[model samples]
Target: MRFTTQRKRFRDLSEQEIIALAISSEEDDAQIYRGYAESLRADYPASARIFDGMASEEDDHRARLIALHQQRFGSTIPLIRREHVAGYYTRRPVWLVENLGLDRIREEAEAMERDAERFYVAAAARTTDADTRRLLGDLAAAEAGHQESASDLANRHLDADTRSNEDATARRQFILTWVQPGLAGLMDGSVSTLAPIFATAFATQDTWTTFLVGVAASVGAGISMGFTEAASDDGELSGRGSPLKRGLASGIMTTVGGLGHALPYLITDFWTATILAFVIVFFELWAIAWIQNRYMETPFFRAAFQVVLGGALVLAAGILIGSG
Candidate 1:
């Protein structure tokens, strides 16, 4: 005999169990919608209103499901949930929804309703009980109606101008939360580590020693930048998003930036490693300039001039110090 833990299949669930699951799913969806509403209320009020309306629709569905359960299966509802049933649709966390951007949340909401509609239709087919089947059919139709009317709801709450404004806000939030911090980290790691790494290379004339110094400098800088960024802002007022995410972006990019030039020191020949490191440093500066031009909207030539000049000065200082 084989012993295994397995979830109950959807088709194996009884009418009462199915109804109970439906009620629970509706409750979960309603809570999720409300969470989306609350999270977006501060930054994107228009989008928040749409979520609020969607939550209201979910509440209506939940009330009807409960009323039907009371009429047929009595006041006590079963404790079954999506987790109890195999192959059931699962919802993503509400926090993830907020991070997915405003438009993506709308798309997810639409998909959630469609999933509900499909589940109910399937449940209606599996059940033999008249009342249960009827209830499932009604819920399916309600979900379909919600999907159909979703566009109308958006039109009512989010007009063209409001939508555009909301999109701009969402973009700005993304830049602030992820891009800006990451770019800062990259710049710091690339430029700041350049001098030390090159200076060590010139001073030591040993590939292994240069590589070790570069690794230590890069790793240290990454740790410092990550912690600094996370501690600098809680994101309550700045709306930059979760500190952990920002810290990760900053830290990872910083490490990458430093590692770019650092890795070249693996070459045994001093001149070869020095040449490759210089090449890597040159590209890193250009990349920093390009990012500034693209995301920060700084003028291309101006950014290039600023970055290249500063990087050259640092490079020169390192070479001179090492040579001395």
Candidate 2:
């Protein structure tokens, strides 16, 4: 009974602990916003400027809280975190956060402001000390005001021209991050797998052998391409991401793309397998064309023409080489 009571006491945090946790959270959020700002300084200058303003606001809030903390308690604040609480939202690393579109980032900024406001308000309610309570209330109000402040800052920094530029830059980054790598993978997988698959089909005239060769080619190509992409760039100039991560993404997609057509060869009938394989190839080419048009901003006709032409050339080359 005594051990149970002690465990319960250990699980609960005091008011000061909660306050300290809030402070640390604010500091971490501010640093993340600053990092995001720095990352977009070159390409999305307007968005970067807005994030810079937000970071400054976060810094100001941190300073005010620190001063208030020192006045109420002491110069030294104890370390505390959200995890110390039984049910608190966890903060994610900035890099790992998905959907970094401009509107999504803006929404994230708004969410941060809302969370800060709620945290401060809750802290103020829990505090017994008048000064601490007052400080927390003030901080809460300030955080509440940040939503409008962020918008005003955006309006000031992101004029029509700047906004257009930022949009264009964002589109470009999207292309570089996902589209380029995915497209390269798709092209490699679709084209590279063809030779082994068709060669085995022609040589043995056996569906099982052809299917096995295709599977082997797809898997091998995926692994090879993934490593090659990851090792190719350190992302110094590209700003994609870690080479290993991007490479893995690219490689997996490439293999999947190639295997789509190859898998049809699993059919025992030669004519059926050939027909399905051709159909898959057609679909693969169309999918690639769509991705180029959608993400890369290429015209549909142009993308279709380019992808189809390239695929045909590769197919012809594979057949010729296999025959030779």
Candidate 3:
């Protein structure tokens, strides 16, 4: 299927096909901008307004292009699109871009405009007719000026205070959706599993057995934490964000935290592996402390003291139990 479904080269397209491609590209761009507008409307109304303006601009472009097509060719334009042409510029799926940060979305928009400008320039160069070439050149200029238009729109819509508030909201959403749950999961995995893993290690003095226990504890804790986080909050009332995203963050981080020290047990030398594991535990505690300080806004020294003390106590308890 892949080999059979060959894409047409942009250079080989007729003027009508190029126009059709432009129409579809403009349509697609308009839809993407609308999707962005809708996505940000709830949180960043100012940014949403900017996207709305851009979408309207795209619609205008599409309408003008369609009028030109009707005047030159016919009422029935070909259904050619970006995907139909090989080496044509492509837009990312709106859903993928929408899920990113607000600034990232803006950057993507800029990139889209640049891609359009470049396409139009090349199309104008390849055109034989004076009118078609002039039209393509004009479109290219319009696309080039879009960044300035967007800036003007931002200036009118997104004032300094409003922009700051929206940015803050975005950051808070990120913290809630990712950092908070992930931190909790990491701390739980790194600290809670410590006693069991260390106890097993010291008790058995078997590297393979310790590795097995560590892996089991890490995986089990990751699963439990993931499910619990997802089930606990639907994100509608709490404003935490999508439960699936939070669950994934929590799950992945939890496993990583437990596996940090667990992996050292693969070394054949018992003392060497144990020493490395001890070192890894030290680093894990510090990392948890750092994350708390960075995202949760906890005082660094206090977070370090608490995490290290709690971990040390659990580790001591495990060692004492194993020795007895």
Q: Model 1: per-residue lDDT, tens digit, 1-324?
A: 866548898778777787788889988988998998998898788888888888888788789889988988899998998888888999998877777788889888988998988988997897787977887898899999887666677888899999899889988988998999999999989988888898999998999999999999989999999999999999988788889989988988898899999999999999999899889888998999998998899999999999999888988898899989
Candidates sorted by TM-score, best first = 3, 1, 2
- Candidate 2, 80-151: lDDT as tens digits: 766656545566677755346666676777787888788778867877778668767977888887777898
lDDT of each: 0.88, 0.78, 0.90
Using lDDT as the measure, the top candidate is 3
lDDT of 1 at 51: 81
lDDT tens digits, residue span 1-324, model 3: 366558998768877887898899889999999999999999998999999999998898899889989999989999998989998898899889898789899999999998889988998898788967887898899898776788889999988899899989999999999999999999989998888888988898888898999999999999999999999999999999999999988988898889888889998788899999999999999999999999889999999999999999999988888767
Decoy 1 TM-score against native: 0.88
Q: For candidate 1, what is the lDDT?
A: 0.88
C-alpha root-mean-square deviation, each candidate? 2.8, 4.6, 1.8
lDDT at 98 for candidate 3?
90
Clashing pairs in 2: none
